[model samples]
Every structure is written in structure tokens, then in C-alpha cells.
Target: MPTRPRSSSSARISSAIVVAATLVAVPPAALAQSGEVNVYTYREAKLVAPLFEAFTKDTGIKVNTISASSGLEQRIATEGANSPADVLLTVDIGRLKEAIDLGVAQPIKSDVLDKVVPAQYRDPNGLWYAASARARVVYASKARVAQNEITYEELADPKWKGRVCIRSGQNIYNNALFAAAVAHYGEAKAEEWLKGLKANLAQKPSGGDREVARDIAAGKCDIGVGNTYYWALMSEREPDKKAWAEATKVILPTFQGHGTHMNVSGVILAKNAPNKANGLKLIEWLVGEQAQKIYADMNFEYPIRSGVKPHAVIAAYGELAADPLPIATIADNKKKAATLVDKVGFDN
Candidate 1:
């Protein structure tokens, strides 16, 4: 993990003195007494909690938080119009789209978000925006595969047969990759790639990205696909993870005319947020320099904002062209991606 720069909380505090003094003249005690907002998230606590803490420390807005990986949409649905959740944070375009489809999240008007995040990475109406991005890069075992030769299509070549390992096609990450395929190759060609790729796998699709790395390190497969950040995450968590990280290197694959598929960890404002003002504040704060720096340092994800470099581990992997297909296309073609997954029997 890269060293975290010192918190710029003082800079924020200096800026807030005038605002805090002005709010002191107001009658409402909500900004001072409770000084709090509530958040619901599907991401890991370590990845997002600090931002809320920083917001609290700077603006005096206490953040009440709940961290869960599943059934968030259902929980929000059950809460209905009475829900206290002010913000929603999570991954994958499908999850964000689900929030939009369910009408659980509301449009947020933030000039900051618009200027910092690309249009393709966010909804036109501002239902949500990506805070950070991860690419679906290939990892090749250092001993078995040489660099610069693998293309997306060539992964299915007969020479590489029984040389691949992947997680379940049902995984949202893989589904998004297929969605990218649909965008670039058309449904016909994308389905062909899925069918062919499925046939080349060395074993049944079963584990997450880190497991894919482990398989490659163990020689269970010579090559595999996974998000670039997982390798860094694993390496940071334990010494045992270093072997897997060292055994393989990241492959950009963007060299073959199309950039690799990418996804995001993003946020949306809740439709009936009890703290709507605070929600927008959070969104604005996230895309700003402070939170963007934390996201890059802690998660090994690329910051969506301009001028923010990737974390050191990610930097060590070198760089490549990202696929030009708009990431929003992933959400639009999601259904087709699923249909093709089924058509090609990808679950087998």
C-alpha cells in the first residue's frame, strides 16, 4: 500500500471556520447537536468508513453507518420513504442501475462531480457517479507466459487451452466484462468469445479474483483474468499474498486496439434522504482532492478525477490504453450480456 498523505483536515477546517461561525447564528441545532448524517454501503468498511469520518471531522457532521454486502436494495426498499439513509455507496454498474430502476436513489446536482468525473462514467441526470475505477486485466504467470503477446481474443487460442481459470460467469465482474464485449464486438462476436473462452478453461469457474491469482501462482492455470486492484489488496493483507503477487504480472491487453474492460466503486444520493444537503456535501467531498487521494491510496483503484495517479503498486504495473467504449454501455447492455452468458452456457 502507498503511504497515505497527511489528512488535509486542517485545510478544510480553516475553510469551514467562517461557515461554522455563520451556522452558529442560526436557530436550528441540527448542524451542531447531532451534526450527523447516515450512510448505507455495500462496500467493505475499511474502504469507505474513513471518508465518512473525515467528513464528520471537517464539517462536524457525524456519520451513522451500516456496512453490508448483500440485500442493501431490499433493505432500502423496506425502509421506503421513511429511510434515514442519505447516501448509497457500492460497486458495479448493475448495482447502481438497480438503485435507479427501483427509484431508491435520487438525482444529485453537483457541479463538482460533473467537472471531475467523465460523463460516460456517470449518469446524464446524475443518479450516480464513479468515485474510482478498476480494470479487468489479465494476469500471467511469470514463468509460463511472456509479456506483450496476449490479446483478448487470443486467450481462447488452442495453444492456451486448459490454461485459463476464472470465477463464475454469474459474478457481476465477469458479467460486466461480457458487457464490454457486447459493446465492442457486437452480440454475435461477443457470444462467440464467451463460448470459446468457456471451452478453454483449465477448471470450473469457482473463486474470486484473488483466487484466480492464487491458481496461477500454484500452476493450476498459466493465465487468468481478474481486477487489477485485487492483486494489490491481497499483497497488502498478508505476507502469504506476496508470492501470488510476485508469481504473476498484470497484462494491459489494451494493446489490441480495444482497451480492457473496467468497472467502478461509486455513490448515489438517496431519494428520500433525511440529510439531503449532507448527501450532496458528501458527493462533492468525494470527488474533491481529499477523498480522491484516500481512495487512490487505500484501495489501489484509479481515481476518477483528473491529475490523481494510481497507487504505487498499480503504478508499478505500467500503463495501457483503456477501452474507448463508454463504461455506461456496460449498464445498457447488461441484459444482453446475461443472455449471451446463458446462450453460451457460461455457468458450466
Candidate 2:
């Protein structure tokens, strides 16, 4: 893991210190040309390190990573033609699109990516590809909510009023789900649905997905919408949070019969990637069965590859019949989605 460092305002403030903290260093021109890839990522260092290591072990190519919370797109833009970024690793389609919008990423034609990732999970132009997925699902009180099945529309039903606990509707996760709603139902009905769901809030929309589980366990609410992996994390990896998982059960909710709304952790190729070949190799490797298994087993995420299965811990949630809606279609509605979020004062 890269050590935390203070960031200076200027783009050249040495990325190693802040916006560009590198986990492993290979002098730009020398090692990059020989056998190394420079990666600028938004994912946590610990989460992606193993995959990088395995890639290195298998191919004998070096991996150097610069991890960040935000501004990677802008940073790459500032560096322009001189940028060493080979790949941009990020969690959401919105961020992936942002990199493209900033003109820092370029499209790549990869047969491996085209074959492994579904059409809905990648850019039609091949700009980015999702490596793994997670569904927006319900964590319902095991003791209170008896039925296993529920729909996204049902959250607005009067019976669930004053019972739903959720994070800020403005968060990217919820925005994606809400955007899916807008795409599925169109603007007018989507707004009405948001208003209804907001009216059913147990309290103000607040907290992360795990806290939603915590709140449900405390009986603060009867049900909450969260991602798939948090329940698995609580059940196995996080002993301290086991009671939260025990107090609730995962319910796969759909948009009517459209199937569960899903999101992804994805990657992009940098326009000025100095080690473009290595970067492409890494991207292709990520969707291969080996890297897919590492992602599934270690990250508790659903693999993007066709035949690979999710970690047993996550698979126990039940089959994730993901909605057929193109993720980009849902992401495209982000502006309208956020507008609806504020229009309804969902957080209030």
C-alpha cells in the first residue's frame, strides 16, 4: 500500500506525494519501455495490489501504481502528451466516463475485452470496460420482513413507509440506481417514484451501505437498500459486524421485471500511456479467469467474465440476474437523476 501524503495544489507537485502516490516505482522511460505499466487508480491500494502482483508473477512485467481519491482525470489532462499513465482504474461508470470527457483516456480495441465483458458493461466505442459488478439490493430485517421478494417500486408502497433506510440519494451508487429508474420509467414517473420512496424514509438519507446494515440490525429501520458485498464482508471478513448480517437477509429487488440494477469497478486506457502494450496486457488479464477469480474471491465482487462465479460468500446472496439495461444508458441520466434528488429534497 502507498503511504498517505499531503497534496499540493499544482499538478506537478510530484504525484508520489499526493495525487500521484506510486506503490512501486520504475523510472518512466527506462523501465516502462522494457516491461512496466504505470497505473493511476481510484481504487484503494490494498484492494488491487494482489491482482497487480499476480499479473507481474505470471508475465514478469512490473506494475507501478499511483492511487488517488479524485482528480486523476484532471491530473492526466494537465500532463497531456507527457503523461505516463497507462491505465486509469476506477469504481464507477460515471468516473470512467469523466476520464473520457476530460480527454485523458483513449479508446482501445481489445478482442479479449470485447469477448469477456458484456455489451452493456463496456463502452460501445471500447473506451472502458467493467472488470466486476455489484447489485443494488435490499437488506431487510430477518425478524420483521418475512417475504423474500421485493421490487424497486415496492419500496414506495405505504407498508414500507417510515421503514426504509438508505444512504444519500445523491451518492453515485444511488444515483446509478435512480438513473436506471429514470431510464426504465422515463422522467415523469421516475420523479413520482423518488418522491414516494423519499416519503418512506425511516430517517434522513444518510450513511454508507455498511451502516445501512448496522441500522437495520439496531432495529432503526425494517429495510435498507445497499450493495451486495457488504453483507458478505460483514458475515465473514468483519467479525465486528457479523451481528449486522445476522440481523438481516439480502433481498434481490428489481425494477418491475427488468432485473437487479448493477454497477461496476472498471478501467480505462490513458491517451498518453507510455507503456501502452503492458497496460493492454493488464486490462486483458483482468478479465481472464485467473484475475477474475482473484477479484471475486478477494474483493467479494461479481466477476465480469462470462463463466467465472462470484465468491461463495457473495454467491450465497442468490443469483444476481442483472438488468439488461446498458449501464451507460443509466449513467447518461446522472444529471437528471441528481436534479430529481434535489427536487424532492431526498436527503432532507
Candidate 3:
């Protein structure tokens, strides 16, 4: 919600130092062109900014971004009848579905979106569609773990006891993974799997996906569950991250059976988006081959569009079967999935 004053480039450069002093002075409209598209997202700013800049370069459209905010839903709701945002981008189908349920997102009627995004990956009503996907899989230390193959239900084996690492169960990513399980097996069986998983923890689930990878490399645990994209990011960003990669082999679970659990970061047009033509144009540009490639390179995720090759690191992980569950199912059952998490004590 912070607004920068409208000024020449030189003045804009100078004001960076006076940001605190300028904070109380202006409304966003005073700073922005009326035709700009506003985006609200949880994606890390570095990962998305360049893409937005590229979109601008291609089309001469201006994008005003608000990244990494916590109260996005409330912000969208508050913008209400007078909302300025043209697009909403966020990770996880849960949030996308929430936007639809709240009536903040309106169905887009783009033929490009329909053809390229895949039928199961998007809302039937077109409230939102994915740009890219990330896989959730297990990582096993090369030095200690000897199993060549494993299943999601096999984590409970006595050999892995006190050696599994994961992030907090409250995270939506983990909840979605569990929901994928629910789709495969009934609730009673999924709860049994959760109980067994808790019994075998390397330590209590405590950190981000990178942290889980770090623990495996540090010899604190032999196996961990984390999103696949983080592995590539870590390997590219820090040398120590490579150590983690070297120590473990990515095991995309359910490959031979149900396929790996996956999730997406996607975009939706606002229900009352003022500039609908520009919005449609922007959506087309995002799902285009060039934009999809940028997403793959920056984040180590798969392009939702077919035939676009993933990044080198992701290719090294090798391809695996993806689950066939309609992604909307994960969004639809998210609340029920959360209740199951609590009922079964995944946090404990």
C-alpha cells in the first residue's frame, strides 16, 4: 500500500533516500498513471519483478506491484467497489479458490487461457488459471539412505525413525500434499499415514523447504519432504546449497503409482477489472512461451503449457508421473484437509 510520488527519473532516484519522510504525503493515484495494472502476490519479488518488467517492455503497459504482503485478501476485499487491481497472482489453489468464493475474481473468457493452461489445472468457470507448477517430493541423503524406491506411506518404516524432516504442517503446501493423499485414499487411511509420519520424524517440522534440504545435508536427518523448485533455487544461489543437492537424490513420490503431488502459482483477473482489454492482453503474454520460460528459469518450476522444457536443474531431477487429480479438487477440499490435519495432530 506504499505509494511513490510521480516525478522525473532523477527525482525518483533522489527520493529513494527520503522514502520515510515522503510516506505520509501522497495517495497512490497521485503517483501512478490511471491505466496501470496493479498486481497483488505472495511470490518472492525478485522472482516476479523481471517478468513484469519484460511484460512492460513487450507491450508498453505499466505494472504496479505489491509483493509479499500478509493481508492480501483483506486488501482485495477493502478495494471492493473501487479496487484498482487488474490482476491477482498467488501460489496455491487454496488462495485462488478463496478469491472465487469471496467473489473477488471473475471468469476470464480468453481462448488462449483455455487452450494452453490445461483443463484440470484451472477453474471451470475461469476464475483463475495457473502459470507454472512445482512438485512436492522426498529427498534422501546419499550417504545414509540406501533405498532406491519408496512411497509416501513408507516413511513410517523403522529405519527412517527419527530421520525425517519437514516444514510446519500448518503450511498450505503440506496441507495440499495431504489433500492429494485424501483424494487417493479415504480420510481414515490418510490419517493413519499422518500418524505414522509423525512417529518417524527426524525432528519436529520446523522450517522452510530449504531448511529441510539443509538438515538432510547437515546429517541431521536422512530424508525430508520439500517442494522441488527450492532445490534448484538453492543450488543456483549458494554453494552450500549445492552440497545439499549433492548429498541427496530427489525422489518424486508416487511416480510408479499415483504420481507426484504438485501445486501452482497462477493469476486471475479482478471481477471488476477496469481495463479488461489490457488485462486479457497481459494474461496472454504471461502464458506465452517466452513468459513461461522465464518462470521456469527463475523458479525451477514446470511450465503449465506443454512442450516448454524446464530449467537444467529440474531436468536433472528427471521426469516423473504427475497425479491425475483435478487441481480444483485440492482447492475445494482445502478446509476439510485442514480439519483432518488438526484432527490427526500433524503438528504434534
Candidate 4:
């Protein structure tokens, strides 16, 4: 496996990974930590480095992280009790549930977590908690789309036919959103909505959310569905993407009567975490005000903590009224949502 080891605890390097992949030959004893926590994350190493650095700075405990886009949960399972993974940091409740269902996550009970994160955003069994969130909202073209407000149901209206652009419906982000729709309206109604949304497609569902913005800017579509952050990132960061951002405005859409659907970036305590106490500390500290601030500014996501404000770029979109349905509820509907996606051939 390719390796890029980092030595500094204080460096803001995106490559803050000590060992970026699994250690097969080394025994679990060598992996033991006297004052460190091993983390397996689906999130990019650089995006999560500041949180680890802050945790280490405040408490003097080192963080050892191995980051991957996919299969870290399976890696932990393969390591079994020998797995040194103390905490799993990742985004989306669907993946969090996957960790739990794979038996890689253990239940946690933290008063700090319960108080800092709302009930709707955490696992009821305490297996995981959302540290940050991003809403699945429409990216309407400023030049073409006039309506400032939209409902999830409105994406299906006959008026929007040939105007919607989106990524694959099978994507975890869209899956979670579709699952939320199942929770709000029954699976049957959600199927109808999915079909209608698919009918509105200007082109076959392709590319990630940022590409959806590109298509809207290019006049391939008038509106598209995407997470809140990609637009914010485009607006503030990449000079090349600034045109895509400038051409569109975000609309915080909701279910007919309910609030906007929210997907999360959450954390889980490893089932056989070697340094359980340290892992718990890291988990709790993640929800603390300081870490939440990094999430707001650096990650460009909404802090799940009550008192934390969003980054100004995100705040400009307007207040987000997140749907009260528990993330677990949305997660429970994933299989059903995925089935509906296939049944409707939304990707085709």
C-alpha cells in the first residue's frame, strides 16, 4: 500500500495521516497506544486533521488515523478484537448505520453528546452522533429559475420537466435524502416523487453535486439538487468554480409540511476500542465549541451543536429548518429507498 507518514501533531497538513492504510504484519501489541487513539475514517485526512490536532493540543493525547474512501468498516471487522480503531469519523447516517450493522460500532453513553447533539441527529441507541450536517437542497439557476422558495414535492411538478440535474440516485447522499422522503411520505408516494424527479432530468443522472451546479450554469438544466456545502465551496474557494457558484442560488426546500431534510457528518465509537476512555474524550470533545468552529469554517458544514453558528457563506443561504425525523428513521428506510431507485430506474 502507498504510505505518507506525518510526524507533527500541530501541522495543518491535509496529509496528517501517520499510517494511511492497514498494517497487516504488525501485531496488535505494537499498535497499542499509551497516549494515543487510532481512528479509521471515511472523511479525507486533511479535512479532519484540525480536529485531531486540537484534541491532541488540548489533552496531550496523540491521534493515529488511517483514512479511506470505502471499506474502513470492513477493515475494522477484519481486524476484529485486534482492531486498534478507537473512533470512526465519517459523514452520513447511512454509513454510520453500516458501521453499526457490520457490528463495528459499540453503543456509547455520553451526557455531553446527548446535550450537544439533538435527538433527531444521533442514534437513539447511542451508536453514533452527528457533529455536522448539510442539507440536500436545490441549486436553482439565478438566470433561469425565478422562484426563491421550493418544496421537495415541487421538484416533480410538470413545470420542472427537463430542468433537473442530479448525481446518481444510488449515491449515499441522494439515498439518504430519498430515505427521508420515505419517512415523510410512505414508500409508495416517494416512488412517485422519484419518478417525477427523474422525468424532470435534463440529462441522465451523472457527476457529483458540483457537476450538477456546472450543468445548471451551462444551461443544461434550470435547477438541480445538491448538498449545501459544494455551492459554498465553489463560491469561496476554487476560482474556476466561482462561475458555477455565481450562476446559482440555494433554496432551502422542505417537505410539504415538514422542515428541510438533513444529512450528517457523524462519529462512532469503535466496538473494541483499545483506549476506550480516550476515544470517549475525543468523541465528546468533537462536539465541543472549538471543534464545531472548525467544522463551520474549514469544512463548510452546519455545526450540529446548538450554539455554534454556520460559516458566513452558508448563513447567507438563509436559516435551515431541518426535518425533525430521526436520522435513524431515515437510515432504516435506506433499503427501501434503494429498491425504489432501482425500480424506477432513476439512474438510467
TM-score of each: 0.88, 0.93, 0.88, 0.92
Could you tell me which residue pairs clash in candidate 4? 14-46
Give the runs in model 4 whose Cα sits over 4 Å from its true position: 1-30
Residue 343 CA displacement from its true place in model 4, Å:
0.2
Query: Positional deviation of 155 in candidate 4, in angstroms?
Result: 0.5
Task: Give the better candidate number (2 or 4) by TM-score.
Answer: 2
Candidate 3: tens digits of C-alpha lDDT, residues 1-348: 122334467344433221211201223552234545667666666677778888889988877666533445455666686776677788787778778877888889988999999987888888889988988889888888887677787876676789999987778788888888777777888788788888889787888888888899999999999888888777787685788777788887772367778898888887767666677778888899989999888778889988898998888877767887888987776777788878878777
Query: Against the hidden true structure, what lDDT does model 1 obtain?
Result: 0.77
Per-residue lDDT of candidate 4, residues 261-297 (tens digit): 9999989999999988989999999899999999999
Report the lDDT tens digits of candidate 2 across residue range 243-314.
Answer: 999999999998886899999999999988888888999999999999999889988899999788888878
Instruction: Tell me which of candidates 1 and 2 scores higher on lDDT.
Output: 2
**What tens digits encode model 1's per-residue C-alpha lDDT throughout 117-225?**
9987898788999988888888889998876546788776777889999998878888888888888889998888888899889999997888899999999999998
